[model samples]
Target: MFAVVLLAHGDVVRERKIAAHVMKGSVEIRSNHRELRARLREAGSVRDTAVEGIVERLDPLGPVCTGVIDGGVAFGVRVTVPYVILGPIPRETFETLDWPR
Candidate 1:
């Protein structure tokens, strides 16, 4: 999921270009043998052409405890949030419901 976000955010923009080249036209290989190689080479070199503001390192995140009842990834598009604890249980609702004779 994180990878999907990164791909959409111009992180792997060149990869999208490369894929287009590989699948140009309807079942057609638009590029000649040399040209296809060149396109691939260009795609591989996109990162080399850019320097500023690129993510230098993607340090792995998590196994950190999420503070909500379901704050992390779960099965099949579901998220698991952590349970929240409310301090000092309130008794006002119970008291109001009781009628005094």
Candidate 2:
């Protein structure tokens, strides 16, 4: 459960209703969280721990995003029409991604 900032055209808005999932110890995905989790794990991260976080269902439409940890901050992206840029949290609170041991 976390907030996601969605960007479209030229607007940045935070979405608190959406879901989030820890894809690994470094990445998290939001929007269609469950399907993405299964898909992500199928792609690689097939560890015993599965995935961490909630799978909040969202209306399937357009515009989705993900992020990662870098230099103690979340810094990653999803290349699309407007090119979505993701987080660094608040420079204080950090997301503890769950990974299999």
Candidate 3:
């Protein structure tokens, strides 16, 4: 499983883990990769569009949202305080997280 960690500046607040395959499908959809979305759906990685809402609500800490996966970064809006790390991030990523101080 991978997870999404919510951050306020460098402080971690909330985190939610999800299935890696579901996360992959979500990243593709959120990134607007049309071909990959179709492929993921066909391959049964993503069942439907409802997964989008599920992933978006994973971190309801604030309004700001973004996705970072496979070292790729994309923001739904300009980066700012109270942002969400939409990761299906692996175990190694957990070790690198900026824990609350």
Model 1 TM-score, 2 decimals: 0.26
* Candidate lDDT (C-alpha), each: 0.31, 0.31, 0.39
Candidate 3, residue 92: lDDT: 72
Residue-level lDDT tens digits of model 2 in 1-101? 33453322111112232223412322234445566556644643332111112111221222234443222212232222222232333433343443378
Ordered by TM-score, highest first, the candidates read 1, 3, 2
Task: Give TM-scores for every candidate, taking all chains together and pairing residue i with residue i.
Answer: 0.26, 0.19, 0.20
- For candidate 1, write residues 1-99 as lDDT tens digits: 121111110112222233453333412233354555466457435633332113232122211111323333222112332222222223553345446
lDDT of each residue in 1-101, candidate 3, tens digit only: 34444332211111122233533444434455566445544643332233445556654432334543232223321222322444444567557767899
Q: Between the candidate structures 1 and 3, which one is better when assessed by lDDT?
A: 3
Off by over 4 Å in 2: 1-29, 45-101
Query: What does candidate 1 score in Cα RMSD to the true structure?
Result: 17.1
Query: How well does candidate 2 score on lDDT at residue 60?
Result: 20
Per-prediction RMSD in angstroms? 17.1, 18.5, 16.8
- Indicate whether candidate 1 or candidate 2 has the larger lDDT: 2
